[model samples]
Target: MTDYSSISTKYRAYNITPDTLAGIVAVVKKFTEGPATTTIYLDDDHEVKDHNLDALLADSFVKAQKIQRIKIESRKTLGPDLVHSISINFESDMLRVVQVTITGDRDRAILARRELDTLLHGAEYWYSFSLAPRSSFLPFFLSFLIPIVLISALSVFLTWLFGGEVTEKSTTGWVLLPLVVFLAGYFGLKDYVFPRLTFDIGRSADRIKIAGYWRNILLTGIVIGIVVKIAIDRLLK
Candidate 1:
């Protein structure tokens, strides 16, 4: 089994009718709490309406039902879906609001969920990850930090291509290399990677693809950069 000790879950809720809203309010009241801020999505008009519990309870059934769907989103937001399909129950009296949640690095998601649960004890809630948890952390570090380092190293090494060394006399270039590298890597990786993936409701396949692409690119760049650097150093000598 995959160890969830390293993975954390995010909690959210839907199905927040005025009835459930009132129940949530009463339960949270015990702890001087309130209901989650609900964001409603309307299918007919394609509009989003945000309301706190108080406002939802005050609204008429027609208006509340206009909610069509609702969700309590976590701060760790995922990209919108490219395609979504839903089955509506016309015979049902209440909107079938779905609970949207996600799982991620254990420390962050667990802390957030624990606090949220403490804040709202009675609300129906669930948790999940937008993507599959990495079996390890190396993929994340590689995707996020290594690119910046690689870009910086690439910039500094490229100076040798012109038989120039980064020295105290070129303090400005050394200082600027990281910034230049950051922008280049940001744009380069974004351009190279994002296009290979698509955004969706959950489990971003694109990110997985990007991880593989990033590993390949990082390894390739290092190998090529080292070879070129060695050649340049020899020629210059």
Candidate 2:
């Protein structure tokens, strides 16, 4: 078999007419099963050449797949006169695939295309779909515990403010009030509050993560505050 690299190298050396460039890009599109975006970079002096090449790539990619969207971008840079980079981005409910392929071969370009497909199927990529939860014990504890402690402390303060006098008579109620509130908030808000505040963050983490540690703590505080208020009223009566 003729070496594709050798053929590509020869093709590059000679002036590739507009017609020939179109034919080449057409052949490359046959390898990819889906839509793609093709970018052609050429020396500033080669504007016509770049435009022709891009149009060719776009047309061929569209012809290859009805579902695929093809776009062509061209820019003139100092280094290479003619170079092509193709990037394909595709996603499904379970998986996301991104591929970048560059080649000189008219036929061997398919090698890069096939490599990307294989990568999409491999265990590393496929298993990523399972959406495993990541563990960060410290963050998780802080997310829940810190608020409970703070709210409980606030309740203690509020009891003192209410003239409960921090004496032994009032001490148990003061402490118990906050503790009860903290627990109630922690449990009640666990399902409602925390989930709402951390919804975006958790979902972004593939629904396996949580954030807003301080927010969770604050929510607990709100609950504790209400509990302390009720407890103080009952005790006064």
Candidate 3:
């Protein structure tokens, strides 16, 4: 069996600052040996070209509009024709997913990954690959004891204060779900699941096995379920 013949990395951003963004762009441009095509995707679905990304991120208003993604692509001249591209996907104002796709032989792939590791090591706000570990902790009381307990207690207090008759078991899912959702929202869900399928027909098929897609789905379900549950309760009453 042959290898994937490509290398990719997904970077999750905690909060990408201006300096970090500049570093990210530099790392992306470094993948190519010569001039490359740099494209920026905007929130309005309008994509355009700008070298230093000045047009996309020039001012407060423009930045507020948000650059959804940025891509840099070029071929390597010294070696066999290799497809190299860097995709910077912005999930939100402070969240990002940086995808690096480089094609080459085993040795070259190893070196490229090493360089990527270096970049990831130096990046201040970006998390290297995967979204499951953080969000999965939200439902667990041990993880968010302070806020969960405080909010749960507050919910009971409000029920009494508003004369809703606070019960002995009043602190329940109703109070916790929204707090979990709010905390989950602040953390952000930034990575996307890669297409997973097998084909013997091709020379090589990319097998992407990512942990935490289920966790993300569960988190999403909890959020949606809470919304639906609220609607149902209100309508029934």
Candidate 4:
């Protein structure tokens, strides 16, 4: 016996708002290519409704429910060879995080995934993100390195500027360190951790590969901790 069926799965996260439901609906329509069954699990009542995306995602209905999760199975499609299952796990926070699990046939799963991303990123109100890339390390490394270098340089330059003996310590160093930490969190993490980074359609995120994303996150956490410690130490003195 030979088995040819292959399944592929991907995990993704998106920052969604009330305004972006239309984008989701459009993606669903394109995916199914016909009427689809959507199961909207509302906190008020958990019901499975065989409705189209537009009705399922109506603004009034959406506003009413504290959505726990949504399961959308493709009912009809131009490409019937693939089975599509989309699970949107909702998190109750200001970020309105939607962790999506996409399971599809192996060959075209990537294509199916691209459709949703295209819509999410193309629209103004939707955003998606994946694990940071290798290039991420460079900026974070710079974030760690540049602060000390700039501060050390400023320390000596300011002393010379003020007609004092050159020293490798200054108030500017302390100020810059904390500000760097604060600014990175305020700007970088805002755009990184949650998915609200300045984005272009279908182009904002890159998947963390099989090398493993958790390691990337953990390493970044360690770097962040070190950076913060340096800042705090400077602040205390």
Candidate 5:
């Protein structure tokens, strides 16, 4: 016959001292690890009952032993487990330190911040860096306006030279012929010349490979002549 016996469990508390007090201090100062909530247990019957765990940990000059164990606990589901132990075997006086390593993207973020600062300091300095091209519509618009002004001035000069004679027979045929030539040229090339020239000048300089520059010029001149003649007839009436 055999006798059955119940098993008894024993609980004990132990002291932890880090190998390197300096290393430990360095780690705490850098905040590399998250804040740890520590609970310390002591033998109430021991003589050194006045010293508490917080006070012992807070001591600036305290040197930890090489083989120290720390108890940690987790508070959240994703958090690390609680009641975990950490062993420290480093030198006691080297200062405990924890350093975080930055990844490549983090370095890039820092560089971007620096560039933004530079841009903010002197924005006008980078204005020429715009993605837009030079010699925009304004130049072409000025070019068109210049020719019209010149033609108007010439018409006025000729009129003045003729002493403002209101004779229809002398000037009617001359004006009507120029006007007919202008209308025929203008209507004939409006679909081709204007768009081609505008596109050539507006687009890349290398893109104007199509020939007929002289033809286009002649067509545009005729159109302008017709319009001018019509205007002059209206004004003379």
Candidate 6:
């Protein structure tokens, strides 16, 4: 892994204000663990007293200072109205760094980063299926097709239940099978088998292995069931 501290914490925010900076500090402190610091680049000299950050700002930027044990550095941006870029430094093994950058939206970035930190440090992952390249058609195709595949297999089950031949017409009710399965899995099956489903957090100790394994197993069962059902449907025809 690249050294986070060495890699200058460079980010730019449009229309940044004293309150915005304070809120950002609050978010970093709330979501992250361990000792961390914030360096605020100000445009001019200023004074800070009490917890009121507004007093710390003069016109363009707030004075840089270390407040509490949290270690805060505040400075002025290049221009008050212009975009503001700042860097932060921290010691590793104590804090986890989570940064999110979004063009035209600082609030979304902060919200997303906070949520991401919670998810990563929140729980462990057992299993996962990566639907990557959001722009690609694969995720959508699979999302629709996987449900269909599972439903087709379930149609075979119904055939066995009624001692009737499995056919396209006979399986019309399978249209509702996807919803049924979702409710059943979410409420009943998922808890006993897979605890949670999460995005790929890379290979880490927090990765939930059992959940991914069970997901794969369930997928395999669906494939087998679909194949058997297809064969039975063809024979009946």
Cα RMSDs, all models: 16.9, 18.4, 14.2, 12.5, 33.6, 16.1
lDDT of 2 by residue, 1-237 (tens): 222221110000111223433433454454433233343322232212233445643443322322211223222222344333444322221111222334343454566555433433331322232222224456445655666777677767767666665764456466677678768866776433333211111112222233245565676866887798788889989
Q: After superposition, how far is residue 3 of candidate 3 from its true place, in Å?
A: 7.8
| TM-score of model 6 (CA atoms) | 0.30
Please provide, for model 5 over 48-166, each residue's C-alpha lDDT reduced to its tens digit, 9 standing for 90 to 100.
11113345454332222111222221121212432211211211111221111211223332443343233223322122232122246665465445544545444443454444443
Q: What would the per-residue lDDT of candidate 6 be over residues 117-216, giving only the tens digit for each residue?
A: 4443333233323222233477646744665566656656655544555555665454356547665674476433543222122221122455557778
Estimate the lDDT of model 2: 0.39
**Model 6: residues with Cα > 4 Å off, grouped in runs:** 1-76, 85-164, 171-183, 186-207, 223-237
On TM-score, the leading prediction is 3
Clash pairs detected, candidate 2: 35-68, 147-217
Per-residue lDDT over 60-179 for candidate 4, one digit per residue giving the tens place of the 0 to 100 score: 655454555555545443343555554443443333434445555443445656665565554423222322222356754564465457545644443444345534443434444544
Order of quality (TM-score): 3, 4, 6, 1, 2, 5
Per-residue lDDT of 79 in model 5 = 28
The models' CA-based lDDT, in order, is 0.41, 0.39, 0.46, 0.45, 0.31, 0.39
Q: What is the lDDT of residue 40 in candidate 6?
A: 31
Q: Residues 137-208, candidate 1: write the lDDT tens digits.
A: 765445556656766666665665445556745633554665676667676665343322122112223444
Candidate 3 local lDDT, 150-211, one digit each (tens): 55565554444334555675543455445565456434432223211111111111111232
Candidate 6, residue 103: Cα displacement in angstroms equals 6.9
Positional deviation of residue 4's Cα in model 5 after best superposition, in angstroms: 82
TM-score of 4: 0.39
What root-mean-square deviation over C-alphas does model 4 reach? 12.5
Model 5, CA-based lDDT:
0.31
Task: For model 6, state the Cα shift of residue 156 in Å.
Answer: 4.6
Per-candidate TM vs. native? Answer: 0.30, 0.27, 0.45, 0.39, 0.19, 0.30
